[model samples]
Target: MGAVRKRSSADRPPSSDRGRRIRRSERVPDESGGTGMRRPIWTALAGFLLLAGCAGGEAASDGQGRPDYGEIKSMVKDILQTEDGKKAIQETIKNDAVKQELLFNQEEIKRAVVQALTSEQGKKTLRTTLEEPKWAATVAKAMQKENERLLRALMKDPEYQAMLLDVMKGPDFEKMLLDLMKSPPYRKQMQQAIQDAFESPLMQEKLYAMIEKAVESALKPGQKEKGGEKEKGGEKSEEGGEGGGK
Candidate 1:
């Protein structure tokens, strides 16, 4: 050949490329579960947690109708590690679908959480229920499992599944869990709750020891119940009676 044919850059093999390249079609989903561009996993997880908390109870309906997002935002800020992460949480709180799912009117949920955190009753509840390390761990784990179940359900619907996968690819969904561990406000909150409990006349060291012993006794491996199925039957009777009353 008298003249060498010139090869275009597009014709170059990927293996010879000097810089890394990613597929445009492989970008992560937005907070609303819409896919287009890739985003951080922290962003995705923040979105997921916020959505899950809002969706999991009767509050979703009540919240969607009159959201106190400022409260929700404050709680998230009170609990997350970084400013970037807090911003992501705030943005998630502002999402419309989240609002509708939780029945929170815009930012009302945020305000409610903040209000709860600052209030005596809210602080007491957190101390009584969420302050225990073991219980906090349990609630966190259960909430995560529930969120995954919800995400799996979302994926079963053709459109939503594709969106969720995109979000997963952006960051380790587990990072959110890690961030939660690093939060100072939560640690303080838990410590305060434990202190409150310890101060109670009804919660002396011996009593606390006894309660722990009882719980351990009831949790024996392979046991259905400490008293077996009869206790379970009694619980059902109470539940049934309550339902009938309602």
Candidate 2:
């Protein structure tokens, strides 16, 4: 008889299996002999609450068959704290519709900002905040790095460099510079620098060396005169000896 051919696993039909796998969205059989359909968490939660009179019984509620605001808030908070709920919220926020809904017009934003800044309470708050030394220092410290980076970028820009040159060459800027140099604070700072130099050990050593060099220079001419006179005396003695021999 001819050999019977066996069908390979890969050649077999997909539906030939006896067992069926359950899909995530498919209905699951419950122990109560009923099928449990997959539903959204919020929908299931709302359904459960409605079935249980919102919050257990009438006594647990606001004397009504509905949950109180506090209970509802706590329930919502608990749901929001869950990973699934957070992921859902994040997905909802990332939706195009949500972005369009949240976005405000530029004119509206500008008007709101102007109103806020111009308001009496806002001005007072700003003035008080600025008047605080600690707050001012903290804000300056935070902005220092950003300001330096911005300045560095501006310095590299040709337009910014031209603008800076224009400002620097202006009479107002020159006056400001001169006024700063002539200020009492500037004089005091100069004095402090001089005092520091005088107090420095290196400066003191340099000064001492300078004084020794000056003294050596002052005494050098006297030594040179004596040496010249001794040379002349030796020359005269040599001449006298030559004449005596003659």
- List the candidate 2 regions with Cα displacement exceeding 4 Å: 1-59, 63-128, 192-246
lDDT of each: 0.77, 0.85
Give lDDT tens digits, candidate 1, residues 1-246.
Answer: 323334554566676343333443335444566643344666899899988886776676887889899998997777786788788888997998876777845478788889999999988998898878999998888799888988788868988877767766666766775677679987788899999988988789778899999998877753765567888889999999999999
Give me the overall lDDT of model 2.
0.85
Q: State the lDDT at 199 in candidate 2.
A: 99
Candidate 2 residue 229 C-alpha distance from true site, Å: 30
Per-residue alpha-carbon lDDT of candidate 2 for residues 1-246, written as tens digits (9 for 90 to 100): 122334465465566252344353245666555444444566889888898884566556555656478988999999999999999999999999887776856678788888988999989988999899999999999999999999999999999999999999999999999999899999899899999999999999999999999999999999999999999999999999999999
TM-score of each: 0.17, 0.32
Full-model lDDT, candidate 1:
0.77
| Number of the top TM-score candidate | 2
Model 2 error, position 66 (Å): 10
**What shift in Å separates residue 87 of candidate 2 from its native position after superposition?**
27
